[model samples]
Target: MQLTFDADVEEFRRKFVEFLDEHMPAPGDVTERSKSSAHVPDWARRWQRLMFEHGWLLPGNPPEFGGRNATVLQQYVHLEELSKRRIYHSFNPQGLGIIAASILSFGTDEQKQRWAVPILRAEITAALGMSEPGAGSDLAGLRTRAVRAGAEYVVDGQKVWTSGAHDADVLLTFVRTDPTAPKHRGISVLLIPTDTPGVTRRPFPSVCSPDDLDFNEVYFEGARVPVANRIGPENGGWQVANGSLGHERTLLWLSFADRLEDLLGDFRPRTELDRDAYARLVMDSYALRMLGSGALAAAARGEQDTAALSILKVLGSEASQAASERALDAVGIEGLTHPAVTAPPPPLNIEHFSASWFERYLRSFAGTIAGGTSEIQRNIIAQRVLGLPRS
Candidate 1:
């Protein structure tokens, strides 16, 4: 299959590049910011809204749902360009790219009207409640309970590694509705407001830095949410969550592929990435882009492409980790401790990059761990793609 962008997509890329060059933040102008949606600044909110108003935020979304109904080729071009420029689309990128899209698949008409449009409009942000304190990779094993009580479902549970919970207005939460059912069954999804009476949250440390509140721990103590807020049928949340995970994996591969390219561009000459190693990494990154493009193509054609998503996640996440290793090798010891420094301007201008290398290297492990672990992805590829038996 053809790999490079077609003429139409190339032209589309040119237009978007010009638009981003006009609006994206400059190195000096960029504020010191945590990577959390919780710490969204006024400028970030405006920037997100600006992109949304221009029909640039959710390019692949349908027009009825506030997207441009963009072709898959266009979607690939859009994400790659954003990554090339190192643009953070919004503080709530996950909400727009993953959560909102999932809602379209599983939400009721009222649910769509209430949440999806506002998310696309950037009027509010959301967080995912997937990983619990005890159940990280084994999501089906979560113990959080939500029992239906007439008009409301009273929820009581704790979620950890919940990114941006502090700033999120709503949560796409998974809970056990039937304790007697199988591990994967009897679970349900809830669209609960974060400000509910029994809800509480606290920040957690990450390798990005000790003080960085990138992850959060959220607790629900008999949190009452309207029964109407449920996504899909009761005890059928596993299916809805599966849909959300598909969107998330697709977006993650896109983000990581672009980021790998940008990282190379940012530190190629300064870091000690030798010719052979650099070429290898470049090819690996190219392969990732190709896989990502394939996934996008399938999506554009309204296909699931589960195998592609799983393959891309496994390969892309490992490639990023390997790329980070090379970057660290180039930086040696200095990057491990130093947290800020001036970068080469213009052609190689990478703001917040000089002293951020090792820290980024540390955080890169999360890529492999989150969105289903590398081991899990491998099992998926082995079992689903290769049609292997569950040994």
Candidate 2:
């Protein structure tokens, strides 16, 4: 893969930067809530639509799906520019980036026409219905049942930690199609609409914010999705899931890099000790940039390696967590208070730092646990990357 951009890419970059500068949300409005992975805010949705109309929403998708069929390097550059600006391409990443990519790769032509185009156009939100009450990182152990009844599958199960399930239009769901088969062998993916009868959702608020309870518990009882909605062959959901996870891990790395950059810009030191801490934080971020570039380079190769993604996941999440922790310590008591609460005044840009990062430490920790936990990443790295034996 080429490390340097050609003249065409350089031109694309120049225009993209200008586009972002003209369209980015005013500084104060830029926050995690606006970029919620599960919930698409009205403003953010509008932004997505604007990009779609201009053929910039899903640049890697085909022109039939409103993308320009951009090259891999162009796609990579797009992600890098968005991260540099801390701008998310779509609020419903579960729908567009991860699940849609899976559908494009594995879905039947009809299924792709039905699902992929709408997803790329940002016309619907979808939640991944992985991570059952008991399955989680050990997804093959999932017990969610989908009994084939004629032309449809009657799904009955519960999905926990289903981010944005309440707001989603559909679920790219996994279920056991042949329970008597080996654990991984029976699994299948079904695209179930959220409004199907017998589907229910309950929100679970986070420590990060009361208004943003992005996680939910979703229940399915005899909810039927058409057999045609299945992405791959029946009892072949694991392959689809692996493809989805690769896309997800790539996004995780990019977002972590973006957040770390933002944290550095927002860091403010009031003491000599704080200066020492900030220095370490900057150095760690610099190292992470190099590590992150390696991951991007891997993606640019046009084929993903799960082992490589596992390595990047471990490094990126830890680097993000470390930065968040340092931000809290840098501000001392001010970090404990809400930015809206009454508090002592900070000097100069310190106020900006305190306000932006007051609750960020908690958010970052929660984010690390999502997608795949740090512990899970370590296991992947040890077993798959290092060829370590399972004791």
Best by lDDT: 1
Worst 10 residues of 1 by lDDT: 343-352
What would the TM-scores of all predictions be?
A: 0.88, 0.87
For each candidate, the alpha-carbon lDDT, in order, equals 0.79, 0.75
Clashes of each: 0, 0
Off by over 4 Å in 1: 1-7, 14-35, 266-276, 294-303, 339-341, 344-355
Candidate 2 regions off by >4 Å?
Answer: 1-4, 18-38, 41-43, 271-273, 301-303, 338-358
Question: Model 2: per-residue lDDT, tens digit, 1-391?
Answer: 4557788877877777887777766545533243235566655666777677666777777766656778766777887886554456787877887888898889888888788777766677888899988888889989889999999899999999888888888889999999998998899999988999989988788776666667889998988878988889999998888888766676466666666777777667778987887788777777677776676676666666777777667777777778778777767776777452234322111112334455777667766676788888888889987899978
- Compare the candidates by TM-score and give the number of the best one: 1
lDDT tens per residue, model 1, 38-125: 4456666677777777778877776667557778778778877766555667667668867788888988888888998787667888
Total clashing pairs in model 2: 0
